[model samples]
Structure formats: structure tokens, C-alpha cells
Target: MRTVIRRTAVAVTAASLALLVTACGSDKPDAKKEAPAGDKGAQSSAPAAKALSTAELEKLLVEQADVPDYTVKADAKAKPVAAAGSAKADKAACQPFADAIGGTIATPAGQAVRMAVLTPKDSGKKQSPEEKALAGLNALKSPATRVLLGSYEGDGASEALNTVKNSGAECMSGFTVTQDGETTKITAATPMTLAAGEEATSWSFTMDMGGGDEAKFNLGLMRQGNTLASFYTFSLGGSVEELPIKVIDAQEKKLA
Candidate 1:
């Protein structure tokens, strides 16, 4: 599983860093300024790409109408928070991934639209007493999903996606992150297969919180033209075996 958020969905208490494993887009000072490899020739003669503003990002983000069954909040309205780039990985090579999952990018000027999504706790249908009692165990595999829609300039978006791809692949063994004096240990990182956008890479991780508390989380990155979409999901019911397909599909459609 991966780290993202809890689907208990609507209410977030303190914005724990342990469940944040989603947003990772940047335009860091050191990144090269060029066009994406696939479109270099065409973009070379085009004007430099401009990032979408916060207002534009909001319009592009999902609204309750888009996902009527769940709760969605974008930008500053999204709460129980963690900032991207606030976490540091013990291995320098894995820092990009750390910042990625932490919900912030490593670059200073990268523009992004952030959101929090939660699935319904109740299935909306009347449940038998037995079903209600078993609900605790049969609850949504992933209750909360954290999202990032990052827009880039030049090749910044592609560069960000590649950085995440290389690092998520290379750091599968495990690593630790330190944010605001809190430490999170990742016991495992498992890659996943996915089809979406122009290109995508995915992973699920096991996190140990001591006291024998372990949770599985899923993290995925999808590239859509000059933008990057990152989804991180977590579960309190048990292993989050699947990504939030409904949420992802809706967001991707909005991006398209």
C-alpha cells in the first residue's frame, strides 16, 4: 500500500505526515530549462509554457458535482495538511520521492493545484445488521485520497515525472523521512502497473508506526501533457489494495 490520506474522508485531525505520499512536482533551481523530450522539436519554436495560476487551477480541479458521491476540497480549502518539500529523506537520492509523498514539490516556483478527496463511508444502500457489523472490516479499502495537479514550464513537468520515476524505482528497498521532528519509516516499496495519461508510474508502500501498527499505502504519478497528476491513498480499514480509480478518472477527465 502507499501513504496518502485516510478516507474516514471528510474530517482530518492534525494532518499526519505518515499518510502523505502523493504530490511531487517541481521546477527546482538546478533543473535544466528545455522542452519535454517527446515534444522538443514542436515546442522549441513555441512560446515558453506558462504555469496555470491558482485561480485557473481551482477551476480545473474537481468539484463536488464532478464526484457527487464523495467529498472534495481544493487548494487552501483542503485541510488536515502537510506541505510538499517539507520532508527530508535519509538517502539524498530518495529526497525527491520523500518530498513527493510529503505533498510538496522540491522546486521553488512550480505551480500546483492541490486537493483532498474522500469516498463515502456508507455505501448509500441500506445494509443488513450483519453487514453493518462487518462494515468495520469491509469498509472502503481507501477512504482518503490526496491529489496534486502540477503545471509546469518548459520541461519542468516531464523532468519532475522522470525524477519521481527513477527514484521510486531505485528506492524500493526502503527509506525514512524526517519532517518537523517527526520520523516515518517505510518498510517496503512495491511497484505497480497502471495505464493513464501520457505516462505513469505507481507504487505501494508498507509503513511501520511501531507498536506493531502497520499500514499499506498506494502512490501513483501520471503525466498529462505539460501537467503532472499524483495520487496518494491510505487505509485505516486494512491494506489499501487499489488506487481511487473513480477519483483519478474524474480528475484526469478534468485535466483533459
Candidate 2:
């Protein structure tokens, strides 16, 4: 059991928690279509938005100082989708949503920054030994929250946000995504209400990890100008019914 836990933990951290999910829900006919590349009218008339470079994004991403109770660090494993089509959705229309959960932007971004925010092992003071032990267990049950900040030029940020929204609406009940040969099954996807930045959207997912083991994964997105921020929460050995508001709030402030 411990070995399995360790392996699953690594995969979850590796954008494999960055994500690959499956769902049992039947297909819905409401999938949305994007404008054709050749359609000039499809393009926006507003002046192009300036995207923050990778270096700029790195500085803008949430830091340890901003989240005092959590350990925030760069995520070495979170990278762009593989060129070999390693991360793909079972339903073509759901690809954008899948990509968002896997630590990448749906619409292409000029650059992105990824980070992992680990929950504190204990909160408050004056804990008895038993209390400390229980706190440790609680901490173990709470998985790291992965954050991604993506910047785009032109209207890519809007495109990215729309793509994710449409996909979530289409596949809210379930879907499957495979990353590097392993599959992540999302048994349910529940929409969330959030107010931040220029626009925001979020979802809570029930991840079926097979063998009767399951994990709670909550995902949220917010866009400020040409930048979009994504917060991904994954919990194992237990359940999580809420999104990481603190992480979202911190990133939203930085982007603002």
C-alpha cells in the first residue's frame, strides 16, 4: 500500500497529477466549435494584448511570502504538452479542458510558469502529541496544489479561457485523458462560481484512481488581461470538497 501511495504521489505531481482523467458519462451533443483560422471576422479588432514573458511570469507567480502557511516552489515536472501527442483527451472537444488540468494552457501561450503549493503540516499552536500525529495525517491526506500562469499575445488569453469553459460545459459529467501511457479518469466534473480578475471559472472533479482508490481534484481558472492563472488541487487517501481559495486569491492579486 505504501509503495502504491508513493508511485501514485509521483505520478500526480508529475503533471500526471498535472492530469490524465476518465469518466463514465455518455457523450453530450453540445460540444462547441471554434472559429476557422481563415475567417478574418473571427479575429478581434481590439489592439493586441502584450503577453508577459517567462521571466516576467516567473516573478508574477505566487511566492512563499505571499502564502505564509504553505510551501510554494517551482514545479520541475510541469512542462508543455509533449510533441508526440502524449497528453490527449478521449473526446476531441474536451481536449482544452484536459490540457488545462494537465498544467498547460488550452490556447497556446507565449510562456508559462508552474508552481507547487504544499499545505502546512500543522495549523495553530499548543498541540498535544496525539494532536500533532493527527495533524500529520491530515497533512499527508492533503496533496500539493499545482499552479500555472500563462501569458498570451493577441487574443490567445481569451481564446484559451473560452476553450476551457466550453469544454467544461460539454464534458462536465465525465471524460478521459491520457498522459504518457497512463489514464486519469474523471468520474464527475462540477462547475464552481468565482469572482476575480476580468474573468474566472472553476470545477471540482472526482478522480477515480482504480482499485477502489479515489482522489479529489479541484481546478480553477482566472484571466487578467493577457495572463491566465490556473489552480489545481489534488487530494489522496481522503476527499476535498472545496477549491483552494487562498492560492487563487494570491495569484489573482499578483496578476492584478
Candidate 3:
């Protein structure tokens, strides 16, 4: 079971790298740019493309052929819940961490969101209950290596980027996750290197489940055009390393 978690975590981390790389390619409009008053009418006459709907955004996600040696499966669809009551920490200050699971700024409204999980072709047999539970926590677990991809379309990519960059400092302090009435405390969160995306951020954190059990988390975020993608990977009873640079390179080429 421990082995399964590690493998799944590593796989997801790679996928997360891909998502981040995808976001890096497109340039963000300058936040400070303001059109001349005289040109406002002309600009209004010709508008940007209508943002893709959630369904269209999902269709644009990287496919199996985009990532070698991995089988990409779409995650089961579910309703979006309000980003509240997902977690609680010993310190009230850490409550924000619960929002981590609530979907990123990239998440679009309505039911058009799409997500996929990537597992290595050689992942072997079925996963045990322990593995399922951990994976269920964030749906990033599998017997084989796994990576999760979630995409949403909206004209808010630039807005999302600003939100993440601004809120990251506060959220990094760490907190606890509460689900199914059970609590797991995350004691630390360290920022990871993220040089690929137009706007990207990564973090590694330690989750303490009491009784000597612990898990590590690696999370990455990226934004491109009107889309935003988020990646999450977890290791149970093990350490998680930084995502590889090649994963991003390969994914960026596919997006190109």
C-alpha cells in the first residue's frame, strides 16, 4: 500500500509539471496596460473570443498520446461544493489550508469542468482499501503512479493568477484537513521551484495523521489564456521530491 501511494504520487507530480508547463507558454496581458480613451470604442467593437465553456475546456486537455507510457483516464464527474468546511486545523490560522482542496482559482463555474488521472502502463494490480482511502482524500492515489489533470475555461485566468500570487504567502503556513469527520494535520509547507509557467507556483508539505503516520504533498498551479490547470501529488509514509523539468518540457511541446 505504501508503495502504491509513492508511485501514484510521483506520477501525479509529473502530470502537475505538465500542467504548469502548459500555462507557461502564453503571455499574460500586462495588468497595468490601459487603452487610450479614444480607442475604447474601437476595442469594444472587436471583443476577444468568448471564453471557452467548461465542456470545451475539458476537451482541450492533453490526451493519452500527449504523455508517453501513461494511461489517462477521466475522473468521475461530481458536483462542485462550496469551498467551505473542508478542513480545520489546531490553529485557527491554518484554516485556509482546507481551501486547498476546494479547487484552484482556475476552476470554472457550472458543470463543464473536466479532469483526468494518469497512471503508468505498468502499474500492476488493484489497489487496497488503504490506498483507496488516501487516494479518495484528493483522488490522486492509485496502485501505479498517477497524475491528475483538471481544466476549466473562463476569462478569469489573469484574475486567478493574481489571486494565487497574492494569497500564497498566507496559505503556506500550513493547516489541517478534515473530511468524513476525520482530521489530518499538515505541519509544514515549503515552496518549491516553479520557473516554467507565465504564472506558476509549487509547494511541498508534510501531513501528520497522528499515531506516527505522515504524508507529503506536492502541488502546482499554472494559467494560460482563458484556462487554468492544477496538479496535486501525494506520498504516504514517504518523501516527495521536486517535479522533473523534462515533464514540463515534454508537456509544453504537446501544447505547442
Candidate 4:
């Protein structure tokens, strides 16, 4: 009877060992399996963050500035939608301005600035060429800011400066301009100016990016009734980029 009991105990021990080995082998595959349904919700809701694109930033800035409806041209006889006052600043404006300035060139990683403008709505029957130009500034729906990569020196310097200054740019000295590179930068919270009376009460400035890339750009902000406009221009390495300025509110600037 004692011998019979010992044999039975040995047989039981062998069976237990085999079961344990099988359990361990099965666990390896299960460990590699995907997570259960319980975890799916958490992963789907949290996506990686992304930086804002240039177009996005421009749009954001326009919203902040509160731009109004504007027309481009000096002919007062032209109506806002008819002659000189026609041509709303829209997404279509981006490609044309970009094309005019050779938008294919590379801009530095952080070389963006904001500017705005405000002017009374053209209530007159006729719009002038300058009025149409100003209107062109307002039609842009994006952050029409451009990075000045380079510009030709010599004869074009004064011409470029005058062209910019005439557009309500406030001159900033102490900034450098270099050959074959970027030189200066400007930033703003609103439009620059319009007809002296609309000049911005806020402050704007220029900074050097170091090396041969010396350049200058004017940031502007202003209010035309409830409307606002932002614009800028820069000279770099013999090239100039005139960024489109946009009116955010779409309301026409009216005279008081």
C-alpha cells in the first residue's frame, strides 16, 4: 500500500510540471498582443502639436488688427467695386503679390513681422490711384508679411526707401543693411499710418539679424473708424519684398 501511494504522488508531480511549462509558453505571445479596447479612446484624442504655417499666422494677425474694406488706385472717379475702388483684397491677392516679389526665395526661420493700417472709407464718387493702392493693401486675408532676403545696393536704395516711406512707413535708424544676406527686421501689433492723422500712437522698432544680412522693414497699425490695416516692406541683398496688408473687419473706412 505505501509503494502504491508513492507512485501516485510522482505521477501527479509530472503532470503539474507539464501544465506550468505550457502556461509560461502561452504568456509570451499574449504579452506581444496589442492593448485592449479600453485604451483606444485616450490615444485618439491626443494628437501631436504642430506649428502655425505662414498663411495661418498672417490670417491670425489680420483678425487681431481689425481691418476694414479698402480700395487701391488714385482715381477718385473709380468706385470701390467699379473702377479704381474695385478689386477686393482676397486670397487671390497673395499669389499676385508673391509673384511680383519672387516668392520662391527662402525666408529665414524666424523672419516674420506684422503691420496694419486704417483709413476713412472712400465716400467720394471717384477714387484716385493712391486710393486704389491703399485698397489693395486691405484686401489681403493672410499675414502678408515677407522676409527680406536680399536687395541690390546703389541706385535702388533711395528708391526703395522712398517707395516704402510713401506708404506710411515710419523710418527707423540704426538698422544695418548688408550684401548677399538679410540685414534688419521690424514687427508690429497694428497698421503703420494713413494721412498723418491716422498715424499710430503705439511704438515700433527695428533689429539686426547679424552678419551680412542687414535690412529694414516698417510695421504699421491704424484705425479707420472701426477698421484696421497692417502692412510692411523690406530690402535685402538687392531685393525687396512688399508684403500684402489686410483689413480684418471688411467694413469700409468712413469719414467722420
Q: Which ten residues in a row have the lowest lDDT in candidate 1?
A: 23-32
C-alpha RMSD by candidate, in order: 9.3, 10.1, 11.3, 34.3
**Global lDDT of each candidate:** 0.59, 0.61, 0.43, 0.25
**Candidate 4: residue 170 Cα off by (Å):** 20
Clashes of each: 10, 9, 4, 66
Model 2 stretches with alpha carbons more than 4 Å out: 1-46, 75-85, 107-109, 114-118, 121-138
For residues 131-201, could you state the per-residue lDDT of candidate 4 as single tens digits?
65543333222122321111212322223223333332323322122212322232221223222112222
Q: Which segments of candidate 3 are over 4 A away from where they belong?
A: 1-49, 76-97, 104-107, 110-155, 171-173, 244-256
User: For this target, which candidate reaches the highest lDDT against the unseen true structure?
Assistant: 2
What clash count does candidate 3 reach?
4
- Residue 240 deviation, candidate 3, in Å? 2.8
Give the TM-score (vs. native) of candidate 1: 0.71
After superposition, candidate 4 runs with Cα above 4 Å error? 1-49, 55-66, 69-117, 120-173, 179-256
Candidate 1: give the clashing pairs.
1-205, 1-216, 1-217, 2-217, 2-218, 6-144, 7-143, 7-144, 84-103, 84-104
lDDT of 1 at 46: 39
Top candidate (TM-score): 2
- Supply candidate 3's per-residue lDDT for 183: 60
What is model 2's C-alpha RMSD?
10.1
lDDT per residue (tens digit) for residues 132-203 in model 3: 443344322321222223343444554554454455465566655555556656677776655444455556
